[model samples]
Target: MEEERLVTQVTPKSEDFSRWYLDLIRRTELADYAPMKGMMVIRPYGYAIWENIQRLLDERIKASGHVNAYFPLFIPEGFLRKEMEHLQGFAPEVAWVTQGGADELEERLAVRPTSEAIIGFMYSKWVKSWRDLPVLINQWANVVRWEKVTRPFLRTTEFLWQEGHTVHETYDEAQAETLRILDMYRQFVETELAIPVLYGRKTEQEKFAGALATYAIEALMSDGKALQMGTSHNLGQHFARVFNIRFEDHNQSLQYAWQTSWGVSTRLIGALVMAHGDDSGLVFPPAVAPFQVVIIPISIGNWKENTLPRAVELRSRLERVGIRVFLDDRSEYTPGWKFSEWEMRGVPLRLEIGPRDVKNNQAVAVRRDNKEKLIVSLDGVEAKIKGILDGIQASLFDKALAFQKENTCQVSSYQEFKSVIENKRGFVQAFWCGSEECEARIKEETMATIRVIPLEEEKNQKGKCIFCQKEAGTLAVFARSY
Candidate 1:
């Protein structure tokens, strides 16, 4: 355990966000840069967080009637060319394999930048009748894109993610499935990750390539930058026409099937870091934290015999009730040092048990979010800890939601939009003429693009286009994003 070492200090989040993020990632042992450029290694602690995210989100995905499957990593170059739009969208980032052993391959194979082309090809073979209309399948896998700019989890050469590919008999069914997943993502991110997000459709220029329409959930990080948390694309029949995914209807008419694709990646871990972390260190929501409760036994004279046993027993009690607990009973680290270390790791609750606490049949519980301490009787410690954890999760969410609201502003003119983008740097709501020209100019001049367009009836409301001052009805959110 000496290898655990004393936790190192991180750069302040306010002083420098980029340095603070990289510093915290290393100091907290979440991830590290790999020997290869633009790649990262997910350490055990970080992987545990991802595992918890997978377990919880997988349940929701299965409940919605999607099944898991595996897909090939390499796509034949011709396969990518089947859908020119999707291929061109990923062309700049695609990695290729040109040789096998000592021999040059007859044709280059693409390390999948995305699975649309291959999955669409498979769907063509798998669907022959309307009964197989909705082929709902998902795959958890790693993907490669030769990224020029990379960050640990946010953007990398290779990363882990789950991509869901589905087929539908009708356009309405595919659109319904896409929105359903978008709302599901909203719930999962807001509830489990405790990060508030704005869910809506994207502009034409921002929608996924080959998609009729794309919807996403955008989250405002602590730094006032918007992060696209997840995306669901209504691919329509474009891929079906390209791959020949034809099915015979009950009426005996052949038709191309509509399709959809949606996914969220390990960049979510990066979201968790930015959305809720503070200058002290990481501040994790209880639902996804690796350890919800970390019990540290306070050291005193002959304390091992007196307090160590009780701390171990308390850990057993919590474990019995299915609470993730870590008992730091190491002799090498003092209680104070252990507290700082676990706090830096973002353990939600810390219970300190010393000889006095053992005698009093109580322990001191400290919260990582607010650093508030409370004395608890050991009688119903398990139930009490559960209540406190639920409160912490809710508290973190409320605090983040407040921050999002405080930073989000509604602006009527392009001047105000540019001012808000440069000064406050959060989500700015403004009307757009729904033209790529205006969207492109806004991004070029202000470095802020439309983050989302209202999904509900409000999208139909009329207003002046912030840039062109033309008759525009659609309101859009603009932000400089990661």
Candidate 2:
């Protein structure tokens, strides 16, 4: 109760976006700074959101023929060195352990910045024949990266994520799997999280360390900044050759296994916070909300005997119908206080059952998104609750889609690009000559980078390069990102 009272108000988002974001996280009890500089402790409420996300996404992954597995967190220096490009890409961010029980070890073990090196070693052993062709496996685990600047979920030293690694016999099979996972990620993020995303291929400068190509889903935050939601990479035969993952093919010839790795991390939790949250606090989509409905019994006359019982019964009924509900029966907080508390916590639906309402067999249902209230009859309440939850999920996605549409624009020249990026922050679409030099120049002059290059069809539509004025071959979305 004291903690609830302590959360007064967040800084208005329009006044200060960063402060508003940090303030909402603290007041809403999502996560907090850890004793370590580049780490955070995700609180129960925040972890619950992640748990729901994991449950939903894992179902999709498993259904797509990927099995969950665990790999070692530490990779030997020798193992990482085998794949020099991958090692070099992650060298700066990799954490290392050199001592064991106060004794210096012979070889330093690197904390996984990503699990490709170690997973490749194991795949080399497990995949000796073509029969083990498409080995689709996913790991739900935490990884360590020594980040200089850290936010709670967005850029932590250690974070929870699901990384999928697969091995296929042919390049086409691997490519298909990579694109399929990319589409899968888009669907899961857009449907379950209720956050609209623009997805496509990453530029050469932006692709994963050793991947042949990388694809990602990028979402526009409320502040008009881009947040990469997920990525799927096609590793090709690079890792297979590096790790000696040779297999006998159908033609009885030894061939390297084509590979892929893809993942989405708890950074998504930060995206959800930035995308849909308002100055009030978090505004979680119904599908991923910890408790979709919170039942607050009005603490009026004889509430304990009348309203409380009714509220408890309603909670039971809702739970039976597979709805997550929380009945706040604590006598210390007033109904108004509970409403404010739950609103800040971002429960999609709030039900108020007062003694008078209980007598009339009705409850006041409040929506977190629009603050709309509906007098709902207790009879057949499950159907109404389900409908409202569905509506909230769709409405949140629609609102985010509208925001993205309003913020995005096409620039004909670098001047317009710089102006749009500086004066107004959002996505700026422009034709690129597919040159890393031009990409670096834009990032240097204006702090915006190429976020995504639209897939083949759209990218192939040519125009003059926005930066160089040369005939360009690709359409790319550029933005300042988190």
Candidate 3:
């Protein structure tokens, strides 16, 4: 018991957060450094969490009329070059495939940093009329980009994600589709992942290459930094014109189609860890937790013989109610050891069934988020666990929303903006002049960029740029991002 207790006290919150994150990931067997620099291996435990995310998001995408499809992992050099802006945007990080077996390939193939060009080329070939409009397709794949620095699930040389590509006949249709997907992503992150987000449009300078407009969902992390949780782009006619994707109109004239693309990567998992995890380790929301409950049977001396049956029965009962439950029946580890282990893994709820509690017809239920425990009667343990899971999910979202509100600040002067960014470290809501020069100057001085310009314009109060003091155009949220 003494040795087991020491393991739980290995690291505390007052220490460095980065070190705490590294220790949590390692100790919980979530991930490991790969042989290559700036790359990581997601262990089974971590992958299980990712699997849950994938399952939930995929269902939502499918329900929204998007069909799953696949495209080539490697794109020809000329294909990427077709869209000059996109080539320039992604050129810095692209990983080229030059050799095949022992022979050097004639034209270097670029492992897709994104599938826009490849998918656009296919759309050009497949769609010849308005009937082929709105080719809604999604693909789940891995992409590679060489990076100077990387964190486990945050930034990596290679990462897994789902990308959605859709084509529409009219500009209005395409623009509406772009916003719709952005809202979908926002809903998924907020409802399913239990993280609150700020949704708005990206400035022209920060918009995706080959896109006329870009929309994003940004979430504030516990470290006072921002993470671009997801993005949806309106490609306009750029790709359609480049790929010669034109359709004959009802009036018998040919016109270019409008396109849109969007994606959310595994970086979201990283956001979850940074936003909600603590020194005690991860605290997952019930919606995404792989195992909603873990049952640990506590025994000392002869209590083991009597406690085992009750724990087994409880596990069976929970499973019957369609709850994901794991029974830790390992005799080698103490009940206290199991508690810390599951807590590190971020199991939503934990049930401890000891000899004393079994006799009392109750089990102690603990929540991972608050570490609060309550005695729940075994008579309706299934329903009780379900209610606790729902409560944890709501509580996690409420806590994140509160943090966002606390960190967010409104500044009217340049000095105030700098102070808020440096000290508070979150979204600085202020008026912008809508000039690229002012945006560039702010970035140069503060290393903070305009994160989003809200769709709903503020009336009457706008006067001047917070930095340049020129006539202001709209309210923008600026932040230093991950």
Q: What are the lDDT figures for the candidates, one per model?
A: 0.92, 0.92, 0.89
TM-score of each: 0.98, 0.98, 0.96
Model 3 vs. true fold: TM? 0.96
Off by over 4 Å in 2: 1-7, 456-459
Candidate 2, 1-482: lDDT as tens digits: 34335346877677799998998888888999889888889999999999999999999999999999999999999998987788888999989999999999899999998999999999999999999878999999999999889888999999999999999999999999999999999999999999998889998889998999999999999998999999999999999999999999999999999999999999999999999987667899999999999999999987898778889899999999999999999999888889888988899999999977988999999999998999999999999999999999999999999999999999998889999999888999999888999999999999999999867635348798898999987889999999
lDDT per residue as tens, model 1, 104-210: 99989999888999999999999999999789999998999899999989999999998999999999999999999999999999999999999899988888988
TM-score of 1: 0.98
Question: How good is model 2 by TM-score?
Answer: 0.98
Comparing 1 with 3 on TM-score, the higher-scoring candidate is 1
